[model samples]
Target: MHVVIVGAGEVGRAIAANLESSHDVVVIDQDGDIVDELTYSLDVLAIEGDGTEIATLQEAGVEEAGLVIACTDDDETNVVVCGAAKTKSDVFTIARVRRRTLLETWEGSQGAFGVDFMVCTDLLTAQTIFRISGLPSAQDVDMFAGGLVRMAEFEITSESPVAGLSVQEADRYDSLTFAGIFRDDEMVVAKGDSVMQAGDRVVVIGSPDSVSGFGDDIVTRTSNGLEEVVIVGASEIGFQAAREFEEHGYRPRLIEQDHDRAREVAEALPNTIVMESDATDTEFLAREHVDEADIVIAALDGDEKNLLVSLLAKRLGVDRTVAIIENLEYAELFETVGIDVAVNPREETAEEIVRFTRADYTEKVAMLEHDRAEVIEIEIGEDSALQGGTIAEATADLPEGVVIGAISRGGDLVTPRGTTVIEPGDHVVVFVDANVLDEVIEAI
Candidate 1:
């Protein structure tokens, strides 16, 4: 596949970096310096020109390209680029529109002006913040299928009732399972015998109703204390996150570097504590008892600063540390830096766009990150070759590092074992590591 990317900004760079490995990538930006910088560093073909211009897009081979991604910071520019691409060529276009108003609803045209998709970064980041703070006790919430199914991460406190329960005992709850347990710096997918101790961070996956039920159980079993949240950097993205947290009754202490910027943020929300200071400084964080905060969202401007703040927060004993990483290239490195979650607004926004633009033949092709891996969802068609076979039999000749994580049959979800059969119409979620995506798909 050939991919033409507009804008050389952070989001454009992220999309290029993500597709460069698997697709023939061409990146266009108005700035010559940015074009030159990316041309030398990335594998993408860099073009210095306006993407809205038909000639510039033609020079980048938009006519031959399969996917044209407009990721400029300006929503109008993105729309223009998408319009030009869709008007001139048959390429699938994804326009990045940060403002929620620009996105409107999904019921609109699919390609009125070549925009097959639209991504709203602000909405994506804000929704992520809302989910986390909505469940104060839970460390974080990972939503799947438009919040139809939810995955919640919670830290087991000393007073929690599940402190001494084994994995099997916890799974006794009708619609819940101990998905994964993070303890002592290692992640363990739970088994029947696995135990939940005081310091363990447990992840549970279920429906929204089930999640609420689970939350109720946690509140009764554990002490219901106020969860303090401090967000470093009051960027629009930061403010968006703070807004969600604030709405959920978690008072967010927003730390901004510039005084005027802090004042601007203060005008928006009266509840948020907008403090003017450098969040990267450990001394400032320490003085505020940042470690005592239940959760800290370190969403600063720079990737390095966010990483440093997240690591510091973790070192200071913050329960969960989420870092807003601007550069998708440094996403995996966040885990190494001790950040619990790395939020990439552009890529996440792009995902919504990509999902909207996905072709009929493709089951599910997710852009996991700039590098590393992707989670591809596969559904066994009625006429498919491996329609009624077990996962072991279906993937017998499959390539390496391909794992079938879960299988959804009708409305029921199951973790496939050796004997677990995958019938026709079962939605199978497969995690395909970077090296063997093509081979794994071919085998299936």
Candidate 2:
């Protein structure tokens, strides 16, 4: 397949890198320096031109392209690029936008603006924060197989009950699989004897009830379970997060420095308490009793400001701190320096776009730990290697780094075991290392 991507920003670059390994990729950018850098950094062809122009689309061979992605920083530019590409060919078009109103408009009228699909970065990030806040100590969370299966990444702190337990001992939950463990820079595939260390990050997949049960058991609960939420910023992401909490019956507090923005959001979110003040004001935070918050989310405009607010909140006795990081390089530093989680909007948007590029067999895809591993949902066909055979027998011909996480048959949950027989038409969720992704996708 030939794919054409416009605007070689972080999001575009990530999508190109993921597709360049299996498909022919072409990236377009207006900046000569970025185009030159991408030419040498990735395997895709780099073109310097205006993506919204017809001549530029012709130069990139858009007529022969199967997919066209517009992920520029500006929402208007991305929508225009997709519309212009539609004039040249009947290729599938995807646009990445930051505003929820545009997504809602596009949803109401599908195929409007010549975009076949649209992803809202702010809304996706807000949804991600809400999902992570529900589970204790979860770094990341995603649902698959029509919400029947869930995948979560958790950090094993010293206070966790499963910190010093082996994989076999921790396998007491029903319909759950310990997929992999990340210890420092090394990735360890989970086994019966694999011991989970204090600082390790573990990935698990199973039914929603079992996953929630496991999370509740591992962490030491406080007397007040994650109830009080404080969001610092009136940015689109922050405002949407506050609305999410409100819709779920939680009255969250939102702090904004700008008076007009604070008034606007306050009127929009009646259930939420909106305060107009600087989040970095130590006196104001203390006066408002912000130190008693269970969770503090920093969604300010600048990364430095968000970092400062998160650290201050942590120092003020907040239980958990989540910061919105624009720079991908700062994600690890933020977490290592005491922030519980760092949510990158561009990374989340890129992962959502890359899902549509997977093979026809895969129904859903979730990238974990910066694409080091993937959890994919697929339906078994009659000719698949896994159909009509026990899991132990079928896995003998497959490579390492593959685990059958969960199976859905006839709208019911089926726990996978060595002797479990996988039949045709079963929706199987599998955890696979990125190194062996292509082989596993082809075999299954």
Candidate 3:
């Protein structure tokens, strides 16, 4: 597959790196420095030209491209790039837009601006924050099989019950699979003999109910009174988070610095309380009893402002704090300092685009342990090589690190064992080693 990506920003660069190893990737940007840097850093083709122009699209091999992604900062430019790419060939086009109105208009119908798909950064980031904060224990969460199946990463604390238990010893759940563990920044493929330790991040896959129960069992913090939520800014991320919380039966209080913006958001969201005041004012926070809130979100536009406000909220005795940060380096710094979670919109968008470009086009994909492993879902066919065989027999010839996490047949979820049979039309979810991605795809 040939992929041509427009824009050399963080999102574009990330998408290129993800596809370079498996596909022929070409990147187009107006900045010569970024193009030169990408060429030197990655094994990809980089071109310096405006992506909205037809000549640039031709030079970037748009006519032969299987996928063309428009990801420039400007929404109009991205739309134009997609439209121009369509003129060159009948390629699959994906447009990245930030404006909600434009996205809604395009998403209502097909062939709108020649975009086959659209991705919104604010919406994706908000969804991520909502998932992690809603579960309150998983560092990362992704859904599959139409929300029936789930994958989550839980951090094992010293107070956790399974802290020192081996993988075999911690096999308490009937429908759960421990995919892998991250200990001391190293990826350890989980097995029966692998032992879990404190401060380790473990990835697990299973049904949603089973995964939620597993999280509750391992996390030290009680989820009894996580009813109150405080939002620091009325930015897009904050507003979307508040809305998500309300839909999930949580009434959030949103605070905005500007009076007009606060009034607008307050009107838009009937259930949310709109407070017009600076979040940095400790006296105001005390008057409002911010310390009693279960979680506080820092979503200001500036990274520095978000960091400072999160630190202050933590000091005020908030149990959990989530901050929206732009710089990848600062995300690590904020996590080390005190913030419970840091959400990066650019990285999330890039990940979603990469999922859409995979060769097999798996039902879903979740990157774990900094892209060292992946959890993928696919459906078995009637004439396939894996059908009609037991789970153990089907996977015996494959790599050692892969594990069949779950199997669903006719809406019935099955926790696979040695005797489980691989019937046709069953949706099988597997965790694969990053190094054996190509082999796994071929086998599937």
Please report the candidate that would top lDDT against the real structure.
Answer: 2
Residue-wise C-alpha lDDT for candidate 3, range 129-217, written one tens digit per residue: 88887665677899877777888988888888998999999988978988888886688888889999988888888988888888888
Looking at model 3, residue 412 earns an lDDT score of: 77
> Candidate 1 vs candidate 3: which has greater lDDT?
3
Q: Best to worst by TM-score, what's the order? A: 2, 3, 1
Error of 1 at 10 (Å): 5.2
- TM-score for each of the candidates: 0.69, 0.97, 0.95
- The reply for model 3, stretches above 4 Å from the true place, is 222-225, 382-385
Say which prediction, candidate 2 or candidate 3, comes out ahead on lDDT.
2
Task: Give each model's whole-structure lDDT.
Answer: 0.72, 0.92, 0.86
Evaluated at residue 124, the lDDT of candidate 1 is 87
Q: Model 3: what TM-score?
A: 0.95
Q: Considering only N, C-alpha and C atoms within 3 Å, which residue pairs clash in candidate 3? A: none
Residue 105 local lDDT, model 2? 93
Give per-residue CA lDDT, model 2, range 246-353, as digits (tens): 999999999999999999999999999999999999999999999999899999999999999999999998888999999999999999899999999999999999
RMSD of each: 6.2, 1.3, 1.8
Can you give the lDDT of residue 138 in candidate 2?
Answer: 89
